[model samples]
Every structure is written in C-alpha cells, then in structure tokens.
Target: MAALTIFWDDLSVETALDFCEYLVRSEDYKLRDLAIWIQGSGGPIDELDGSIGSLVALWSWFKSFREQGLPGVPLGARAAYSVITGRPLDSPLEEGSRLVGESVAHYVFKVILSLDPTAHWAVRAKSGRIAHAWDNTPGISMDGGKHFGPAVGFFTNYPDRLSSNYHNAYAAREAWDDTGLLQSVELLYLAGLPSRPRSTSTTESILSPLLRDDHVGSGHREEIPIAQEMPASITNNGPVSAGAEELIFASVGADVSRLDQAAPLDELAVASVLAELGFVSADGQSVSAVTLLSHGVQVQNVDGFALVETHVAGGRLRGLFLEPMRPSEKEWKSITDAFSALGEKLPAHLANER
Candidate 1:
C-alpha cells in the first residue's frame, strides 16, 4: 500500500534535542553516522551494525560495484542521496566509479531517521504492556524492506514516486491521510500577494519539525530513557555512484582545516545551558552533568555510536546539532528520577573521589 511516513519525515534530531534543552539528552543516530564518516576519512566504517546483523549489508553493497577494490555510487543514486539530504549533487567520474561510503551513509541515515521514530508512537502495538522495544505500526507496511527507501526514492528524494494504485489497496484504505488536512494543501494565488507563485503550505513546511540556533536554548528539563530499537535487517543492494561528499571533509573533520577557524565555545555555551537545565556539580553546584554529557555522550546508533555531529555554519551560528526519541511516561519518570539523584549533592566523604 501507499505507506505514508510523514509523521516523522522531517523530525530533526536537533529539533528533538531542542525539545528539552540539556535536561533530556537528545539522541541522534544520524549525527553519529556523520561523525563516523568524518573519522573514516570520508569513508564508511568497516564495522557492521550488530542490531541489523553481523553481516555488513552496506559494506557488501558498496563492494559489489568495486572499482580498484573501492565501490562507488552511480549517477542516479548519487544525485538522489544528495537531494534528499538537502545537498547539491555532482556527476560521477566517467573513468572510475565514485566512493559512496559517505553519501550512502547520509542517505540511509535520513531514511532510517524518518521511519525509526514511528516506533515511539506505535501505541497500538504495545499489546497492553509497556516495553522499551519497537513494534512496527499496524498500517505502516514497508513492503520493499531495506530497498524500499531507495526504490521509492526516499533516499534520493526523486520526484517520481510509486503510483498510488500500485500500493496495497487495503493498507491505502486503512491509512490516515492526516484526516484530510494533508489533502487541503493546494496551490493558490492567495487573497493578496505579489506576482510570485510558490507552494503556499505543506505538511513538510508548516508542520515539519523545526530546528535552529535559537532552538539551542529551548525545551524543559526531563529524563529521556535511551532508546535501542533495531531496524529490520536489509538484504544487500547493488552499488551506486559517489559524489564529493559534503562541502569539505575538513569542516566536519577533527581539524577545522583553517587558521581562522571559529572557536569551539559552543560546548561552553552548552555548559551554561546545562546549568540552566539543573545538572548539579560535584562541588554542590549545577550543570556538571553537562560536562559529563558532552558532545558525543547521548543519542547513540545501533552500533553504540553517539550521534554527536558537527555541521558547516553558514549563518554565523556555530554549534553542535542533534534529536530525541520520545519515551513512555514510565520510562520518562524513571530517567527523571535518575537525573534527580544525579542532581543530588555529593556526600562529604565522596567529595574528593568525585
């Protein structure tokens, strides 16, 4: 069926992190994958995600179109992955294939990010018992499995989607079209406006989750139980092309790549944010937890990699970016209790040990 996954499509980790400031540790797998790419010299990590399987699906896929023992992405998939990530695409090398490690990771990350969050909202699948695990939504059938995202162009953001009639009829009928709200998005001249014509509103724009520098100081304090949902195993797909990756590996790399690089005071600024978040210090002060929960501490991937990602700052706003996985109220309380305990002042004897 036409399994729509818009609920969490644009659900940015940064937005989820902003949902509770530094109080609730925002978890983001996407950023973690990006970090690994930077660490790999703009290449895919050799390790496999144990949650998915011991066999490295991505590595196997990349190796198929091996060029000089290095697999590269094709033009079509290359362009697609770039567009979906909101980046520009470049042509593949005619003489040799491009290295797809970085681009493929980014593409997969975006798709998984969109669908994984759906688990948190699968209340109906709980079987009347609460569990920290993920249960697929009843109506959200990802028929193509791992290949579905690429097939539907979800990875590349290709304009052509599978025809609605080709989808499972039963699932389509049972689907929730946002109760007709989504259908309301139509082109209009508006009551009064200039000669410009543009898509007025969309579920992607008006309703998409938003994240920004201003959002860094946002959200209230709360405990967020770490989520560890494993995505369904994806069989290997064939190789695609590669591009220049991100603007420059240097921007995301450990070295800032320039003498005039901006200072990483973003962490200190976040430390101040942690103080506001009520993290108690070892000396009976607060936000010491911020120090403990620095950039790569929270929100990990299936491989236990933290999604502590860095991005190019074009708007003069430089800082860490990330998301949150919503927890059940019970889980929330449990985490909150843990934080509350951590917030407690250290005992007299343990002061030095701390």
Candidate 2:
C-alpha cells in the first residue's frame, strides 16, 4: 500500500505547541466544571474520574516539554497536537471541538489500536451497552463508518469501528455542544501550568522562548486559579469508594419497596431489581435472578461489586462477591452480614441453576 498522508504533518511544531499551551491555559477549570456537571447529571459515560486522571497525566507530560524542550514530547503526541491544531477554524465550535477531542484520545483509540485492533473490537463487543444494543436493537446502526467516515481510518476502514460509549453519549445530549467535553478537558489540562511566565515579558508563554509571547497577557493568566489549591474532589478525579455496607444498602434498597407488589418475587423479578441497581447480565440486558444466582451479575462503570448466590449452612444466600483484596474477605463478609441483617435468606429450593 502507498504510504498514508497525514494532513496535519505540515503544520509547524512551534505553532502546535503554542496552541496546546493556549488550550491548557484557557480551558482547565471549565473542563473540571464540565466533568462535575456530567457526573451530577449522571451522563452516559462513567469514566469521568478516569478522564480526569488522564488530564492530570497529560498536564505533567506537557510540563515536561518546558524542562526537556521539544524532544521531550513523544512523536505521537506531537502528531496528535498538530492534528488538533490543524482543525479548520471555520467549522462549527461543536464540530471543531469534537474533532480536537478525538485527536487527543490517546487514552482510548491509540491504546486500543496499538494492541491488536481487531481483538479490541471484541472488548467493545463485550461492553454492556454495546452488546446490549447490538443484541436487542438490530435496526439502529452502531457502525460509525457513516458518521465518522474515513478520517480515523487508522485502526480499521473509517466508520467500520463500532461506536464507543463516548459516541453513545451524544444520543442523550442535554446541553448545546455536549460534544465539546474533550475540548474543555484539554483546556483543563493546560490550566495546570503556571499563571505568569518568569521572564520580563507580560505575556505567559509555555517553554520560555517560543514565537510571539503576547497572546496570553499576565492579567488574563492571573484570572485562572492555581491548580494546586483546588478541592481534593476535583483533583482526585475518581469515584469515592463507598463502604461495603453503604454499597450493599444502596444495592438492596429497592427490595424493601418490592415486598408489597402483587405477585411474589421470582428469579426474573429479582434480576430486574438488580438491573435497576445497575447490575446487568453478561449480554448487558436485564439480568435474570437465575443468572445472578448461578453465574453472578456485573456492576457497570464503578470498579468492584458483583452479585453472587451461595449455598451456606442456613440456606441459599445472595450477596456481593468479594476477594482477598479490593473489598477483602472481611469487607465481603460485612456485605453478607448486612444482607442477613436485612432478613433476605432464601431456601435452597428457591435457588435456580443454569
């Protein structure tokens, strides 16, 4: 095959670096605010914490360019920066921002594609949302081939790759330019830099001596908050690890309300209740009680927490799955004890086998 032509290859590295500095300097807090907004709204993507962590790492990487100069940045990152900066200025802000976001998605596309691209599709296939959507809804196309086209044909023929959770987020967009999440995040990453340059120049430019330094005035830089003083919650960017007791209580909270329902609770009803609690079957649909008891169900997004039914001396028991680490055996026992406290013991005969 002929060598592929990268459109942004011709853009000067200095210009791209300036753009990166500008974005980081101008956009960081707004990005955090957007992340908080998404978390508060319970948006489709559950990786806000992960995204924040990535942003933090990216900030450190960008800062390294100052001490090490241009050689410090990876070639891929340089290309990525050029790609982001080369986006057409005349395009709609939403469209431009989305393109910029995709360029910086080293966290997802680059990492996945670097590992056998074809096999990564299997990972997406196994995703709860993608698998559920694929299995149940045959008509709605998950293929990005038409929408994303050939622009991102690196991993596969453009548009051939299935839509990621990031793509699905657009289906439920509430705010205008919800697609700009990545752009805001990129700005937030830049926001971590020092407010004013150490030099005599009034403008704050990244990497001491690069091109024109007048773009970001000292006054403008002063307006951006110092990243260090931000709240721990914003900086940490991970879900608060709820205690096992709290997790179990929240997980089973619906069971109490279901007691008054007309029909007796069966395995399927139990599965639906678990589904409401954010547990899903292997195929990502509403889990069945049989599956929960037999195979166990997975909790989406947040790490840890699985539903398992066990045969104990008293009877068949259902509770959160635990291991030696993570929640530890003691933490798992705490969940089980909490369940027992709730009086949820079931007879062995009620336990369904696969």
Candidate 3:
C-alpha cells in the first residue's frame, strides 16, 4: 500500500491532539522528548502551555458531545493524561513515530471492541482499516478524499456504523470488497433508502337527521337584536339646481349592516363595494371616498347619494346606505334602478333580500 498519507483538515485538529495524547500515555514516546520538541518549534514553553489550555477550554465547552450522539469520554482526557504523566505519546523519530501513530486507530478499535467484542465483521473491517491507516499515516484529512478514504469508506459502506452493531458494518465492508470502490457508496445507498410507507386509517361519523334538527332547534341562537332605531333617510327636495352635479351624504352609528350578507364584508370588501357604486374608479379601482371616521370605524361617504359604514375596530361591515330621497318620480326611478343593479353583485343573502 502506498504509505497512507494522512492530511488533517481543520476539523481533525482535536482528533489529532487526542490521538497524540493517547500515544503519549501508552508510553510509545517520551513526554520529556515531546516537550523538548515543542520547545524547539520556535515558541516559548509558556506559549505552548497557553495553547494547551485554550484547547482544553474548547474541549470543555464542547462537553455536550454526548448529547450530539458522541461517546461520553471527556474530550481532552488523553491529552491531560499524557501531560500529567510526563510522557511523550508521539516520537520525533520517523519509524517509531509512524508505529505509535498507526497504533492510535488500533487503540480506538480495541476500545470499541471492549464495548462489544463480537462486533459485526463490517465494523471489524472498518476498525482494522482505520487502525491500519492510523498506524501507517496518522494525519488523515476530515474532508472526503483518498486521504480520509478509509474512514469515509467505513461510514459509507456501513450506513448503520454509528447506530447498529457490526453486522451492517460487515455487510458494508463485504460490498466494498466485492466492488473496488470504498464502502462509503454502499453506506450512502443504505442511508438514502426510503423507509417503509406508513398506513393511515380515517373514520367518519354520520349524525341522525333527528340529532341534526335538535342541534339547530333553538331559533334564539345569538340573533343580533334589530333595534327599532332607524336613521332618517336624507331628502334632496330642492329643485334640480344647475350646480348640483352630485349629492353627498354621511351617517354614524354602532351598527352598520353589510350590503351583502351571504359572506361578511371586510375593509377590502367595503372598498370593493364603493368601487362598484361608481364613486370610485371602476377600471382603476382605489379607495376614493372611504375614510377612517375614527381609529374605531371606517366611513365611505362620496359626493353621491351613498354612505357606507364599516367598524374598523371590530374589522367588520356595520351598515350601508343609499340616501337623498328624489322628489321627482323620474329621479326616484333612476335611483332605484341604480340600487337594483348594485344589489345584483351583492352577496347572495343580501341580493335575495333586495
């Protein structure tokens, strides 16, 4: 095998530190020698200690690794152990360094095996490869590539690598062996496989006609009390003066009846109603006459014989009006005709009433 060349991506720094600590504690390298090497790396010993402290703090902050589905082992335990024991886990010597470094993956595999000795063949295969790679080249990249190929292969081949025990792991390794590609592809396939469809059942209930009748039997179901109060309709008894091109009318009250009762009219609906009344532009519609009477109510009173009241506070139509009684029979007929035409477009309930 080409000497496994491990390249550590930024994410692998912590893992590398952990592995280094593991090697040191295992007595593979001398701590004093490692310290000396650190000293020789152009930084003062105090700086190295500060750097170590920062790394430890980072590890401590990421203590929720267990919650994120990682093992419960404190992050910097191995490193701390090495420092305390005054041992160098990594060697400056090329061969000894390589050997100790390679053993890191094996140690990890052993730790995993200790948990479940009869781990699946796929797991064993993956562990073996990782151990092999670590022993051969301890500096693997975290990014997916040939450098981190074995780790990716292990995970990709065994989709349940982190979940299920070694059975799936073995299967993935076997598939990878059969095909020359890394096990990662197989793992991807297993992960991407759709789960079985779930079955759903719905039940419907039918009520007896008698029960339906009983439910609506009470006619007093929150009826709005139509008070005997009615506003006096405006009267335009004056002669047809030449300057009187249009007549304006206005009204204010607690109750404003919507022109269309089939469906409730909102502010937009009130605006729509005004547009239909010719007071507003029919083609390029705009809220021409509609004005907020107070923050509590909206009033639309155009310089035509029409007034519409909508309760802005309650956000509902309260009343509508076609005002100014025409003294002439011809004018009355014209007003009635205009109202009838407008009524046609009103909601079914109000249109029916008209």
Candidate 4:
C-alpha cells in the first residue's frame, strides 16, 4: 500500500489550523488520520501571549470534539491532551493518533519490502520517482509522468545514476530552501517505498562490457611495486647540545603533582586553574574552593606547587583544571556541594575571567 507524508516549515498555529481546516474541507484527500507536531508556543497567534492562547484554543477544540461530537475531527480528547503536554497518552484513541502523526512525520511514505518480491518492478518504479525528486532540485521529474523543468533537469540527466538519486533525495528531504511542504511529502512517500531488483540479464548487460577481455582492468592494470624510500637524516655537528637538558611534562592541571619529580619545573597546567582564581561569590567573597579546584589544587595536596594550564584558547587559562584522583565519597560530596554553591555566581566570574 502507498503512504503519504506532509511537512510544514515555520508554520504558525494559525496557519496550521487553517491547514487543518483546508484538509477537512477538501474532498480530494481522504485523510486516514491527522496529528499536529508543534515546535512550541512560538507559533503565530493574534494575542501578545499567543503561546498560552493557542494551547487553550487547541484544548477547547479538542474538548468540543469529545463532548459535542464534532463531525470531522479525527483526534480524540486524549490525543489533544498528548499534543498539549508533549507526552504519549495511555488510551487507545490517543495512541493511534500519536502513532499516525509520528509515523507520518518520520516514516510515513517509506516503502518496505522483502529482499525478492514478486511485484518488485512496479514497486521499484514508483519508489524511484519519489527518490529522484527528493533532491530539492527544481524540475526533476517526480515520475515518468512529470518532468522537473530546466532548473532541476540536471538530476534527470545526471551521468551517475546512484549519485543523482542520493543527492536528489537529500536535497528534497532536507533542503529547506527549495523543498516546501508538498515536495517534502512527495519525497517522504518515495522514500517509504520498497526497492526493486534488477533482472539478471540487465545486470549482466551492464557489467559484461566492462568485464570483457579487452576492457578487463582497463583502468586498474597491475604495476611493479616501488622500492621503499628512506628520509634523509639531518647532521648538525657544530652545536650538539646547549649544555642544559630541559624536560617538559604535560598533564592535566589536577594531576600536575605527578610531574613533581619527573621535571625540574612545570611551565603550563591545564586551563582550569586560572578559572578558579578569578571566581567571586555573590556576597563579594572570592570563591576560594572553586578557585583552588580550578587551579588543580585541593585540600589533600595543599603543599604541592604546580603550574596550571587550561584548555581555553588564545593563550590563557580561565577555568578550573583539577583532576579527581580516585575521589573519596566525602571528597565527591564536598566537590558537588562546592559546585552547587558556586553555580549561581558563575556568570559574573566567567565574564570577569573573559
């Protein structure tokens, strides 16, 4: 069976309502089920606070259908509630509506078939049209019946068939500029269809010429392997050593102590250290705990002196760089509490650090 998918971009609540009305009024479309997936209360409404108003209106409309028995309303009260709350309803009617909407939105027109079906030819042909027109390319024929005009003719005449189908679908399904609601629906339908298999003779016909003795490996003839080449070594006999050997160690700011005996001095630690130093609390006190932690310093290693580095770009360290070395339960709790206290003051500290 064929399916259909409809999509609307940046459509306001008012527009959606009008669309729903149109669908109901139109005699051509026999909508099996309909569901609306609103992004949020950001839809266009006349009232200043239209978000709340639209929800109320939707709710009222749904209530009217449930209580008064409106003639063309497909969604029930529970379905309406689910739409408002953005959650699934437990009831059967609501679940059906939810399934319909979600299926349409994500997988409505997509065709599924077995690996080798008896009616593959017709199914493949129908599916190919949907797939071909999915590219937002204008004028590519949707099927043999309709030709994509000059603007999108490139798709129809594309040299690479596979490349054309892939690109076409991508553009139609995802491209916002050229593809609108109708085109998206058509593309979705095409995608939902099953793929067909090529006849054995057809496959062999396309492959045989390329595999013929004269053309075999025409572009991939075997060649002798090249010998491995070694890079030239640089020789600097004049100054072999600068008299002093420098050892550089790189570690997270929190784990800098691990470098204490490995190197003479630590020049840079992870960026977290600087962020802690500049933190300020709401009561005008410096956030010492956050600062210390950011600088890769903790109560356990108070005596350790290490340079702190951070991941901040532009040659600066602005945040904490402490490592949690097998943190004890108490230490973890303390850290969490410190963060909770510091969270409120983070914005100002971040600005100052910047």
Winning candidate number (TM-score): 2
What is the descending lDDT order? 2, 3, 1, 4
**Candidate 1: Cα lDDT at 196:** 44
Q: What is the TM-score of each candidate against the true structure?
A: 0.20, 0.25, 0.19, 0.17
The count of residue-pair clashes in candidate 3 stands at 19
Per-residue lDDT over 1-354 for candidate 2, one digit per residue giving the tens place of the 0 to 100 score? 121222222223343334334444534333332333233333322332232333333323322322243231232332232234343333232232333233333233222222222211111111244222122110101133211112222211112112242334344644423233333333221322222312222222121221224533333421312222222221123332343332322123334222222123244444454454445544555555555444234433122243433221122223333321124344345444543443353311111111
Per-residue lDDT tens digits for candidate 4, residues 1-354, read 111111221222343344333322321122112222211222121211211112233233332333343333344433321332233445544344333332222111111111112211111111221112122221112333332222112211111111332454455444332223223323322432223422222111121233234652324322212212111111112222222121222322323334332212112321132234332332333334233333333222221111222232223223433333233344333434443344343321111111
| Model 3 lowest lDDT segment of ten | 201-210
How well does candidate 4 score on lDDT at residue 210? Answer: 31
Worst 10 residues of 1 by lDDT: 345-354
The local lDDT score (0 to 100) that residue 154 gets in candidate 3 is: 38
Q: What does candidate 3 score on TM?
A: 0.19
Best by lDDT: 2
Q: lDDT by residue for model 1 over 48-150, one digit each (tens)?
A: 3321221133333333433233332234443211223232323343112222333343334333334332212111132222221222221122223222211
Scored by CA lDDT, what does every candidate get? 0.27, 0.30, 0.29, 0.27
The C-alpha stretches of model 2 lying farther than 4 A from their native spots are 1-219, 222-284, 290-297, 300-319, 322-338, 341-344, 347-354
lDDT of 3 at 271: 57
